[model samples]
Target: MRKSIIAAAFASLAILPAAASGAEEPPHVDYSFAGVFGTFDPVQLQRGFQVYKEVCAACHSLKFVAFRNLGDAGGPHFTEAEVKALAAGYDVAAIDNETGEATTRKGLPSDHIPAPFPNEIAAKAANNGSAPPDLSLMAKAREGNASYIHAILTGYDHPVPEGVQVPEGGNYNPYFPGGVIAMPKPLSDGQVEYADASVPRTVDQYAKDVSAFLMWTAEPKMEVRKRVGFGAILFLGALSVLLYLSYRRVWRNVDH
Candidate 1:
């Protein structure tokens, strides 16, 4: 027992340095949809889309998603016309099939979400040689869930430490892996007028909404998955009761 105590003490000492290494941690946020039964708040998702459109889309892309996805079942559920209007706001490059030449066309619901830059070189040039990642899977890609994402968005105000220097066109974010981020702080309070007047125009509100939207993009079928899982559990529960009854009845006649 004494030897075990000594070993445990040594282990704690070994771990103490890592725990107290002074790396910054992300703040906590309680999301409405997080667990098995959680459902996406469509209104919040819509607001997030607005944030992305007006703000983040300038550098980031949602390349895997189609504009029509916004109108799909279990999504933000924008109407077909609304999706069309949203798509029309951006233009996409297309090849003229008959002429074999490239052409610019109004974005369509069938088209993938367009990137702000035509290619990686343009994106890199605009963003200091580091292109912003496609955000379709960011909510899933980051180890820090919504809270981590929200913290990174809202945690940019900390002043640079006296010994540290931020690179040109770079910004300081404590939550960023290296405490330096290529993307400047993209959100500010009252940055955009929300479609819903009731939604608050604040950095935190924008972060939460956009984080939730990215979560949906990461798992578009979450609602359906949860519903199907619930139905399967109910069916299994009923089947188990029926099977037990059958066993009891059959055994009743054949006493041990």
Candidate 2:
């Protein structure tokens, strides 16, 4: 009789409402932009820049970037003159040697935008205990790197089935720690239009572009590395062919 009562109690508990059960699942979003793994698109990079400037800049700091670097091969592909013109809109600070003060100067190739918070202490204080990580090396620092970012961006989802138990304010993400994250999805399809028609205005397109730009920022010499690697392979292939020909010639006279 006791076992029967206990089973009935458990079955009743299982049928409780989601709120009563304190159950909610993390949001699931489709993060596969373009395909499983896609290279960076310059057209999308420009649109991402627009999104960052208009939305993300309010809370985040891209401290490592100079306005001029936007014209790099993997960047927005801004022209030299266009970059110069764009850089002119922002002011950068320099140490004034004569007065022992940091003075503001128009942004130049040498200057990086000062961080929003003076230091980590101030940054954490400003962000409700969540430190806005310096995105300078994010693409390189994280494992599975670009794919991880793409997944996280689109992982928002609705609650799980009723009666399921999920922690408060915790959303489900297979990639994030504990399947929960404090940050919400930041990109949406058509949220920001691309100035260049070559790039599609999709969430995946934006994610790929920004991720690529971040990767380039992390390793500016990547293109050069690719070129060097290709050249070496070609040289080695030619050398192998020459050696094979020489070996054949040397043995031609002796072999039956």
Q: What is the C-alpha RMSD of each candidate to the true structure, in Å?
A: 3.5, 10.1
> Per-residue lDDT of 215-252 in model 1, one digit per residue for the tens?
88988998999999999999999999999999999899
Poorest 10 consecutive residues by lDDT, candidate 1 = 17-26
Model 2 alpha-carbon drift over 4 Å, by segment:
1-40, 95-99, 158-172, 188-193, 196-202
lDDT score for residue 196 of model 2: 70
lDDT of 2 by residue, 60-129 (tens): 6777887767887745678888777767767766788799898877777556645667778887776666
Best by TM-score: 1
